[model samples]
Target: MSERILALMGPTASGKSSLAERLAERFDGELISVDSVLVYRGLSIGAAKPDYPHHLVHLRDPVDPYTAADFARDAKRCMKEIIARGRRPILVGGSMLYFRALIHGLDDIPSIDPAIRTAIENEAREVGWPALHRELAQVDPASAAQLHPNHSQRICRALEVYRGTGVPLSSWQLGEAISQADQFECIALCTEPRAALHRRIECRLDGMFAEGLIDEVRALMARGDCHSDLPAIRAVGYRQVWAYLQGEVDLPTCREKALVATRQLAKRQLTWLRSWPDLTWMNTDDAGRLIQVDKTAIEPVKTDENNEIAAVEPVWADRIESLMRNF
Candidate 1:
């Protein structure tokens, strides 16, 4: 088994892909992306998927369903294969749910009946999600407390779980966590500065537009497999661009909405990074620091590689106590 695995994580456009590529080349590793949108075939520009070959990417059609569970499964397979080939595996991307699923594992969730889901949807439409959220507070206040009123999908899923099994969603989530996040030995890296990440996101969105994001959305729509409800089309920039293509908003308005949405996504990512355990924090803004850190980190790898049939590999553990101090 390969002893060295690195989970390179950061918010979108935080130079994660570039850093992962550099490390992968230096260490002879394969890249595995953990993104939901990147799984769909036609979401390249909007998703910002790497141009190079990577695992768990472009494996599904636009309409084919995917979940974090699916990602965890495929990622495990990819990692195993990479290890068997005598190379390191570098997990990359910013999808928090996929990372959580991979680390914490998932429970056997209750399946919602179609009729029940439809009924809940109708009620939400009539009374609004916030009102329905209040009702959820009555039945399952614990789950409701953790979820936002505007998060209709999760709120509805929780209600559906309760309606189907007469059990709180929170109970199932707690009871069935795989609890194997700590078993995997890997290096976790994260960047800082929410303002810098926000700026990077804005620039990426602009680049996506310049790369014909509307044309890409148009092509996907032409395929007739995607719509506003599908996860692929609902992805940050894709949603706004699809709206613009449908004549609902102008190009500039679409760009602005997408930028705002991306910023919100960055904020959520930063929150998750702050709570993540055992991560190496580095200022990505400092190229000199990166060069020095890389130099300091490379000797362990060189020593490990020099020994054939090595019994043990040293884990280069670096914990910056104040990993998210800037955030």
Candidate 2:
């Protein structure tokens, strides 16, 4: 029989790590981080990576540039290894793209012609992103609808795809029939009231600052390994912090911008998660029930003579209590 793969997914500051850690203990599972920013080695403060070992897969490494493909490959490898060792694999984090790529194969859209890319980029530079978006809307409204008005890179790519392949970007994506794993189950935990989530986001940002987030970004910048355009650097906190370091904005303005960005990111995450079919949605207010249900689900297969899996129950209960206390 195929081993079970459980995904514990939610937005930033949504207590996903705590929940996943507890779940891991209960189920004898190893965690594979699905976060994009956490893949960078020195980005701990802003990424919020836990100090404890949890079978991390795509965590920060200074020497490597981690991509979605890299994550997918490593995640699959980790799952196999964990299963081989008689443990379940628990996928956790807020990276929607990574999750999507894992469950649904990334579309193999035709590569852009260099000339077309240059043409679209030149148009964006000369006419502005709005004009480029309008051009995409004229050619591929479906693709345009999936992108934000300010998402210049995707908009440019969509336009380039149309110009180069004579096919709409949406059509290519539709043509790719990706299959999901048969043994996988997804649980999406959205801790709400919306007001509470907003407050949590604000508090988390303040805590990040207190944790020396600025110095972390300064160190990253010092290495000259990343820039504003790189997807990793454009993560919610890093972009705003980078702007402040570049003198494009004051410190207070940067903090406010980061907070706003995190809120927006959380909203987007909620929206994306809500759209997932067959996802078991759980409210954070009823976390104990969720943990109980998860624990019950995994109890039957557990059979270690030393009762290692059984030993983790009290730990799970304690972490849940601590998390609820903070909540």
Give me the displacement of residue 322 in model 2, in angstroms. 24
lDDT of 1 by residue, 169-242 (tens): 76665523334664443343333345666767777788888988889999999987578878888888999999
User: How many residue-pair clashes does candidate 1 contain?
Assistant: 0
- In model 1, the clashing pairs are none
- Would you give me the overall lDDT of model 2? 0.71
| lDDT tens digits, residue span 200-222, model 2 | 78888899999999999899899
Q: Would you give me the overall lDDT of model 1? A: 0.71
In order, candidate lDDTs are 0.71, 0.71
Q: Cα miss at 212, model 1 (Å)? A: 0.8
